[model samples]
Structure formats: structure tokens, C-alpha cells
Target: MQTVKYFTQDELASLFKAIKKKKSKYWLRDYCIFRVAYRCALRASEVGLLTVAEYNAQRSELYCNRLKNSQNNTIRLDDETKKALEKYIRDYGIDDCLFPSQVSKPISRQTLDLLMRKYCKVAKISDKKKWHFHSLKHSVAVHLADSGLDVKELQHYLGHKNVNSTLVYFQFTTRQQDNMYKKLEQRNYLV
Candidate 1:
């Protein structure tokens, strides 16, 4: 099986910085979409289908209707994601689709793919070909897993119907294995 690829937190930060340097008017919208995807661990199609109506600003939550498995997930919005989305909505006067085309329609999957490529190029992400838009979702899962989130909870968070789907992401590499051991030792859990 091909190993799943994921970004480290520093790489994610670099991507956002690269997006910020773009001169396009859609930078805010793009950044908001990227942030929401990473934070919510959304699929590209799910992110494309997202509309402003899904966001409950008062509750700081998003009602995500994922396209692949027809899963309806209620995701809690972090303050950073909430603020970025709120500002994008306000600044762009976006009252309909969150990421809209010039024709005022939801951006297509192709467009989302192209956008990821563009930003990844700007960020100078290594071996970009091996990574896809779904890597953001993997990144969230792996990062949260490394931070000690229970696999069961991570499964629910990723909206995976099967626990095995979530388990694949935790198949650690040698460096990750070492890191996990070090973390356990620091917590005195090695005994």
C-alpha cells in the first residue's frame, strides 16, 4: 500500500504564509478555505460544496455535508478558523458560496485541485506530486493523533465509518516511532 502523506505543522504554517503573499483578490477567500479544510479535516469536494449558510457563527460550528460517503458531520470551529472565515465573509461580502467562481457558483473540484497546486508551489512543498488535497485531512488526523487524541475520537472527528480507516494514518515511520517513544519516556509511561 502506498503510504499516506501528511504535512508537519510548520509546513502548514509555511503554506498559509505563501498564500498571504499572493496578490490576488481571492487570497482571503482561499486562505479561509484552506484554514477551514485543515481545521475541519474536510475532503476537497466537501470544501468545494461548503456554503456560508453552513456556518453557525454564534455557535462556532460548521455543519459539513461530506460528498463521498454522504456523511453529515458537525465540526466545532476553532477560534482561529472562526475569525478567519468571519473576516473573509465580511470583507468579500460573501453571502452565498464560501468559495465562489466569477459566475457566482461554488468552485469546482478541478479548481480546488489547481489552487492547492499553486499554493503548494508557492510554499515550495517538497515532493508535491506525492501529496494531494486530501493530505490536509491526513495532516489533521496525524497531528491530532500525535498530540494524544484517542483513535476512537479521531475516527469520529474524521467522519470515518470504519475504525481501520483511521488506523491507517497512525502507521508511523521510523522517525515517528522514535518520537512516540521519546514522548512516552518523558511522560514516564515507558515502565
Candidate 2:
């Protein structure tokens, strides 16, 4: 079984904190971008393609345009993401792209990778080379699976074209195995 690389909740919190401490003009935009990417389980390219119009403020929803033949879906925004997005939109007066470069183009995937590396370094996350922008998607998928989301549901949430694509996350981490053992113990299955 192949192990998926992902950020733990603690690491994600630390990363966001590091991003917040940065004094750059794009700080809020970067913060919101990462937050949304994690929450929506979006690929870096998908995130780059995001547009301001895709955010439905009144409905508190974001329409994700999935790539690589994945199904596209609209995800409801969490309170933190919603608030951050609203503030970013208001502060930046963004008209088109959700994350635009100075040249008025969508931020490139390479730029996203660089930003991830920069923030991971600032957060002092060990094995920083293992954590790329795609880790946000894997992190959310793993976290959601560990939270007891069903495979079908997780598949839909991730916009996986096939359940097999989502099944990799069910490989049972050590934490998940421990949980199973605890559940069996509570049922006296070992007896």
C-alpha cells in the first residue's frame, strides 16, 4: 500500500499561523487560497483556475472546477473560509480571478508550490520537501476519512470519478487501526 503525504491538523494550523505572521501585501490572499484549497480538497491547478464569480456569497458556496476528468462540484464554505474570502474580496477589490498575479493572470501552479515551500519553512515543519500544495487535498481527504465519512460520500466530496480513486485513503492508518481495536475492545471481541 502506498502512503499518502498529507499535513496533520497541527501542521496545518502552524502553516496558517506562519502565513498570518507574514507582512506581505498578498498575505490574506495566500491565507484564503490555502484555506479554501484544504477545505475543498482542490488541486493546485484547480485552485489557480478559480474565479471570483464562482464564489456565491449569499449561498456561502464555492463552485469547484475539477480537472483531470474529475467531476465538478460546488462545496459549501466553512465559516472561517467564508469570512476570509469575503475579507480578501473586499480588501483587494478583486474583479475576476480569485488569486491574480500582478500581470492580471491567474497565479501559476509553480507559484503555489513556491508559496507552500515558503510557508512550510517559516512554520518549521520537518521534512518540508514532502509537503507540496497537493498535500492540502490529501490532508483533507485523509482527515475526513478518519472522521468516519463513508467511502461513497468521500468519493463524491473529492469528486473522484471512481470509488477506487477514493479507496486509497481507506488503507487504515495507525490511528484508524487503533480506533478499530478500541471499538473491538469495547465490544469484548477479544474475549
Candidate 3:
């Protein structure tokens, strides 16, 4: 399996901008898919498996079944994500399946991959990279680390049985030693 690297903040912002351009309906779906994937840190299957009802309307929380593990997860919704999901649900009426097919069935993994490829093409990102499903999990992990979340907190958020699983994400975002600098380098001013 290829390793997925973390994107710099600016790079991520640029990709978001790329997906937001006035392109086609496909781009809209692409944007929604990418944003949901990156923001929620869900596996591709989880994203495709989601249903409109997975969103708790009253609490504004989103739910998904953890992939590879039998755990269940519910997280507070992001505004942009909520908007995208709401739009998709309203437009498609896939109350039973958050991701849908024209035949009124759950979206297949292959279809999800195709959607991913289309977006990556427009954004000029690498499709060969292992940045598909769980890569989003890595992205979220980096984001949380950047936000100063502790490893313990992340362990719980990620639903990891062990804290070591969360460490991999930190490793992904860790800068080279040369890139590290002391904040205390400022001129001495004991004011």
C-alpha cells in the first residue's frame, strides 16, 4: 500500500479553491465528496455507506459505522459539511443512502473511486497516491494535531483501541528536524 502524505495548509486551501471553481455539477459532487472525506476522516466506504438519516437533525451530529472495526461513530457536524450533505440529500433524495446510484441503490466502492479520480483530475492531484479513503483520516489527524489536540484526545476521537495508532498521524505531519525552530529565538526583552 502506498503511503499518503499530509498536505501543507496552503496546499489544502488551494485544492479546496480548485474544487470550488465554477465548473460542472460533477465538480460540486466532487467538492462535496472530498470535503466530506477530508473533514470527517471517514473511509470511502463509510462515506458511500452514509444515509441522510445518519445525520441527527435535532443535534446536528453525523453518524457512520467504523470501517474494518465494528465500532459506531457520531461526530459533531461542520457547517460547510452540513450544507453539502443537506444539499446532496435534498437534490438526490437518498434518505436511505447518503451516497447513491442512479438505480436507487447504495453507491459502490468503484463508483466512489471514480468520483475521487474525477476530482483529483480537475485538481491536478495524484490519483496513484494512497490518499483515497482512510487518507482522509490521516488528514483529519494532522488537522487536529495542528490545532494542538493531545494524543489522548485524538485516540478517543479516532476510536483507536490503542494510542499508538494515533501516533502514525503525528509522524505523517512531523516536520524535518531542520525545519524546527525555537520560539525563544526572539531578542531578549524582559518587559
Candidate 4:
């Protein structure tokens, strides 16, 4: 099986920090886009297809429209992500599209990919080719799996149509295995 490329939590923090340092006019928008993408495990196209109507500010819920025949789901937003979405919506005066381009349409997937590349470069992440926008999805998946989320739950969270697709993330890395072993030892499971 091919290895999945993803950012470590530290790398994600670095990426966000680098994005904030730019202080560009669209910095908030860019940051929110990446944050939402990672938090929701959304594909670039799914991010582009997001609509304001799909977000419920009062409930802090987001309706994710999955692609590639994946199951669509409505997920509750985390406090931080909820705040960011509220601020982005209020500040941008968004009426329809969640992340609109200058043309008032949803931003294109290519633009998202380009923005990811730009931020990855600013973050000084090596192997730029491996850290495309989709890496956000993989990063979140791995992070969630590492956090002890059940595989079935993760499958639903990722909107995977097949468990096999979700099972790929269950292949833990060496560091993850070490962490698990340490946890087991701490709990005296090895005794």
C-alpha cells in the first residue's frame, strides 16, 4: 500500500502561523478555509462547493456535502472553528457561497490548491509536492485515528462509502505504535 502524506500537529501549527504572518488582505479567509478543510476533513472540491446555507450559526453545525459518492453528513463545529466561521461570514458579508472569490462565486479548487502550496512554502515544509490541499484531509484523519477514535466512527466522520477506504488510516505509523505501546505499559497491560 502507498503511504499517505500528512502534516503533523506541529506542522499544522506552523502552517497556520505562517499564514498569519503574511497579514494579506485575504489572510483570514485563507486561514478559515484551511481550518475548515482540516476540521471537516473536506476535499478541495467539497470546500469549494460549500454554501452559506449549509452552515447553521445558531446550532454551530455544518452540513458537509461529500464528493466521490461519499455520504453527506452534518457535523457540529468545534468552538474555535465555529468562531472563525462566524467571524468570516460577518466580516465578508457572505450571502451565498461560504468562501467566495472576487467574482462572488465559490473559490475554485485550483485556487485552493495554489493557496495551499503557497502556505506550505511559507511554513517551510519540505517535500512541497507531498503537501497538497488534500493533505489536510489525510492529516486530520490520521490525527483523529491517533486520538483513539473508533475506525467505524472515523469512517462515518470522513463520509467514506466503504470501510476499506477508512481502514487505510488504521495502519498506524511507528511513532503512533510507540505511543500506543507506552500507553499500554503505563496501564500495566504488558504485565
Highest-TM-score candidate: 2
Q: How does each model score on TM-score? A: 0.86, 0.92, 0.77, 0.90
Candidate 3 segments exceeding 4 Å error: 1-3, 174-191
Ranked candidates, highest lDDT first: 2, 4, 1, 3
Model 1 clash number: 0
> Which lDDT value does model 3 have at 123?
61
Candidate 4's residue-wise lDDT over 1-191, tens digit each?
85898999999999989988998999989988998999999999999889999998899888999999999998888898888788888998887889988787789889998999899889999977656899999999988888878779999999999999998887854556778799999999998
Assess each prediction's global lDDT (C-alpha) against the native. 0.83, 0.90, 0.66, 0.89
Ranking by TM-score: 2, 4, 1, 3
lDDT of each residue in 94-171, candidate 3, tens digit only? 567766665767767777766655555666776446335455577787778767677787776776767767777665
Model with the higher lDDT, candidate 1 or 3: 1
Candidate 4 weakest ten by summed lDDT: 170-179
Clashing pairs in 3: 50-98
Clashing pairs in 4: none
lDDT tens digits, residues 1-191, model 2?
Answer: 87788888899999999999996889999999999999999999998789999999999999999999999999999999999999999999997999987688998889899999999999989976546999999989999888888889999999999999998987844566778899999999988
What's the lDDT for candidate 4?
Answer: 0.89
Give the CA lDDT, 0 to 100, for residue 87 in model 3. 78
**Better TM-score candidate (2, 3):** 2
Tens-digit per-residue lDDT, 1-191, candidate 1: 54878888888998889888995878888888888998889988888688889999999998887765645788999898899899989988988888887788878767877888899999989877534788888889888877767778888888888788888877743445777799999999979
With candidate 1 superimposed using the best TM-score fit, by how many Å does residue 125's alpha carbon deviate from the native?
1.2
